[model samples]
Target: MKQDIPAVKQPVRSKILVVDDEPRIRDACRMVLSEQGFEVALAADGNEGVQMIQQEHFDVILVDLMMPVLSGFEVLSHVREAHPDTVVIVITGYATLEHSINAMKRGAFDFIPKPFTPDQLRAVVAKAIKYNRALQDIADTNSRLRTMVNRLTDGVMATDRDRRIVLANPAFLHLIGYHGESVLGRLIDEIHVSDQVREMIGQTLTMPSDEFTEPTEEIACSDDSGERIVRAKCAPFRGRDGSTIGTITVLNDITALKEFDRIRSDFVSMVCHEVRSPMNSMMMQIKVLLDGLAGELTDKQREILGRVSEKMSGLTTMVSELLDLSRLESGLIANEKSAVKMNEILREQVSFHAENGRRKNITIELRQPESLPPVLANQRNMEEVITNLVTNAIKYSPENTTVTVTATVENEYVRLSVQDQGYGIGADDLKRIFDRFYRVNDQNTRTIVGTGLGLAIVKSIVEAHHGSIKVSSTPGSGSTFTVLLPLVSI
Candidate 1:
């Protein structure tokens, strides 16, 4: 069985072009490179090399400096301008330091002296091949990323530390209504964007490199189409060394979501309004029956009616709280503002809740500086804020505990705190305590009666008055709720 087997062909590693006036040198390069599995082509002079390059693509180009028609320097310049990806190496008898420097400056990858061995040529070519591949990989990755960003629906933009726009996608240009030819290297302030977005970016850029907090805001933008709501989020952009070098802003159009929220709030308000009148009438009728105006009632009948009345009262309170939340969301409550003495409001709330605290043997104490500054706020709303906090404190605390209310001036703002010795909230429940209808479920809080809307309404009112609220709690210890409101300019 002596059957002859055909030889298998190996794929060429690279395509190389050798251009020289000397026929012996040109032939020698072709033989050496061909033996190393490279597809090699020869040229008599620089003119022939350039013509072959124009006709086809080559991975590496080897040229001699002392060419007859066109010099290697000319070929290097042409390759740099036309096919920059192609690696060019210079081979010459005049391999002096000056000639090597000149060749390098002209964009030659590396220099090889005349009478070079095959190993020397292979080593230099291998290094050039590795570098060239790395550059190609980077270019490919950048191209893919740009394509992905351009096709996204959300807008993405990046700026340098100097506030100059470095990268902006097509979606960002459309969102900002920019029809300019280019936006690169332009200052963010010069661009026709919303002031809120510019401020967010500016703040993020100026933040310390160690701290990373993304600032987000809903901005109104108007263009030829119409006015729309855009939610812009800005964060610090960090470099390889983990230092912030710039800022990035991502924008999403939320016009539809906002419209949906408005519609939902309107529906809820209408339903609450219609049910409120009928519910009030029912409550009055129940009160009259309890008073024996309809007829004389037995103890069992009275107790049953009392339970009904209590449930009705809870429902009425829930309805009212929902209505208040609607009004706050609609900005109706924020319209009424005046110079209000927070200390006076605190005194009135403490006195009002005194009896409720006494029933549980809990003391409601107020500590305030004598001459506290007045805050620009709605008096009735501020009173509600105090009422809710004091009521919660008294309701949640054990018998004979004290709920201390304090007011102090803190740097152009009035700091109000309501500290309660109660079954403190756990770390998990503290996060959503201000959310509507969210109640902490546990044994200590099970018997307590509440609509779970007090803290939510308080938070809405506080934010509407340009104030802030925060809470700190430790399990089984106590909780402190603090409010900070800016003082009115005297």
Candidate 2:
């Protein structure tokens, strides 16, 4: 009779080592395991088994207790001490309670009698292989986790419910002037480094978990290299059950960011001062020459002087805006409130910007006031705000575009708006228009002569008065800027 058989898919073969003194038992065991898809190696005695284990890796080891050269107990001890992850099974005819207990106490996986069946032997080996794979997985996961925590730049530390440090990364050890051995198995508050650091940790631990956020403060430290700044934040540490066990703190160094801001602000102030002194002198001398105080000039010479004066005027406007920006950034500008009428300020600003309007033939229109509210604000700052807005509208609008200024009183406050017909700002540039030195880098805005300080100053001056300003615009259309101020002291 002929029979058909189906093929069974098998997992990768597990490795096994068998050490027995009897040749017949070894050959029988090898034949049975080889058919079961196991890679088996043979060792004659306990001594030979130990030598093979020392040189190769195996998932399971089977040893006979009664052997020459070395006993099974001695080999079991060596395997447990050297390769604890390898599963070991002891085989012996002397299978008494004392022998089984002794093998188990020496870390044996299981014990088998001398007259064991093929099924019983395969069952024991399969159980040992399964247990070994679990241990291998756990060890591999721990190795990967350790590598991540060890190489983190920001210091990471965790404590237990008893408030004792359970884990500290390498960065944490380096941050607080302590070695890894010193920080482990120690108390967090017991750290004797910076008092500020200790206090920060103490405060964070006592606070509710919801209250902990990012870095609370930056600490200044002077070292051999120079001054350094470090920021620290602490929050609740969780256990496997998602319950707060302790606090975890992270420290980041940010000395360079703070230094860069300081350097940039100082450079702006210095350049403005250095350039303003000489430019002011040149303007005064040129004014005298144009006024004919030096000599009467011909028509051609007069035209040339006028052109020079117009270019000088543009420079003067830029220098003034730069000075205003420097003052705003340095916190030198103050808002000392005085009673001011919106209608009066708007009329004065429109008159002052009349020449700018004539240059582009743009009409500056102001709605005639009926009843208007007065706000308490610094007169100079209030005037500067209106002037900057009007000047920008004039500079950006095309020929004969009408710029309208409107004033109204709304619920104990006054709303002043300046609307213009010009090429509007793009969405990306609109958000950053008031940032210092941020000019739009597009075709419509690049040709305009500005130091990018006009809108920044306008924003600062309006904010200083405790007023709010907002804008809405569309591309190819125009923009409307509205400023709100308290009708009475806010």
Candidate 3:
């Protein structure tokens, strides 16, 4: 998965200050920005804009070139002095060549004409906001790097190509059981406890390529105390002359992830071993009765056997769902979208579950738009989504409650809804209902045994379709599961 830092507090609302001598233009800009989810602050003219700049930081400032008392240039200059970090955009009623050039030379992030369309203004503001955000991100990265260096607990040591000490932290000396001064000028190979490990490190350093190769896996070293493991990562450092100066290495103790991986592997093996036999026996007996291989029975006896068969069928469904969910969580699901009639596919799956609902005295209704559009999706994948949702509705609903399934075309997309009035999900459990192995705690639900992967599988299927699913419910008022899919032209 692509990892990026999560937005801190809804992206700071992209604060924008619009400065213009005309209140009408300022109000117009404010309304446009506010509609686009930006936090807007208005300032009348350059002087007032400067005052706002001093009072608080604005992410991006909009300055009108022609203003009374103070021109846009003056406001830009004051802001550049007070806060060079804030991006300034020149908004002018009259687009003059000289004014544009002057604004550019004076460090304006971008320029926009006063008679600009809302879309044009939006584009300029987006660019300015992105620039400001990039600047802040760079600053944050540098701060984090400095903090990492300062927080090292071991005696850290870094050397250039000439073997001269370029960086050294106090922890490096203590970690090596040596005086800090003694290790500063010492070659890295001079301090090792194992000749083999030292030779490996030497070979890595002497390699012709400038790229640094960190040991990909953990290695253990037997010191006087006991066995200790260290994880090492290295990256080449470059100088201003574009030459590889040396390598930076960070070492960490990794006894936890290894131990956790071992325990997890063992637990999985144990679970698989424990579950395989009973599930197999249940399935074998079900097949025998399903094939009429067992002794002949009367209608009531066959009905009783059918109930047993249904329970085993549910179990099998759960196990299959669990396996698929494991694959998705492990990132084993591939991207392979195909054109599919979403409503048609959903209708077919709903028929199977509708029969199950009928057996339990529940009514399952399927609603499809008259002219449903095809959606880009995976066929078997979306069937699993619909099945899981409808099954849950059937499972939770009262004996005679109607479970309505609806698919409608809406704004270039299709929404599939499954509503049930069995026992509603609580707000707390509703949040985590899609998480693997999550089950609601209550009397009404504990009777229904499940593998807890049904909703999780449904969530994964919806996401794999590049769509989303949401649930809304009141504790006593029932629940609704809605799946949204983008419509694709055939």
TM-score of each: 0.56, 0.45, 0.41
TM-score ranking, high to low: 1, 2, 3
Candidate 2 lDDT for residue 316 = 73
Estimate every model's Cα lDDT from 0 to 1.
Answer: 0.86, 0.79, 0.75
- Give the 10-residue window scoring lowest on summed lDDT in candidate 1: 330-339
lDDT of 3 by residue, 86-161 (tens): 9999998778898888899999988998688999988999998889999999999978976787588643456667
Query: Pairs clashing in candidate 1?
Result: none
Which pairs in model 3 have colliding backbones?
Answer: 154-171, 154-172, 155-171, 155-172, 155-173, 156-172, 397-422
Runs with alpha carbons beyond 4 Å of true place in candidate 2:
1-13, 22-25, 65-73, 92-106, 109-115, 158-169, 177-217, 244-248, 261-490
Q: Candidate 2 residues 24-140, lDDT tens each?
A: 778878999999989999988888899999998888999999998899999999899889999999999999999999999999989889989999999988888889989888999
Which structure is stronger by TM-score: 2 or 3? 2
**Candidate 3 RMSD computed on C-alpha atoms after optimal superposition onto the true structure:** 16.8
Q: Which candidate do you rate higher for TM-score, 1 or 2?
A: 1
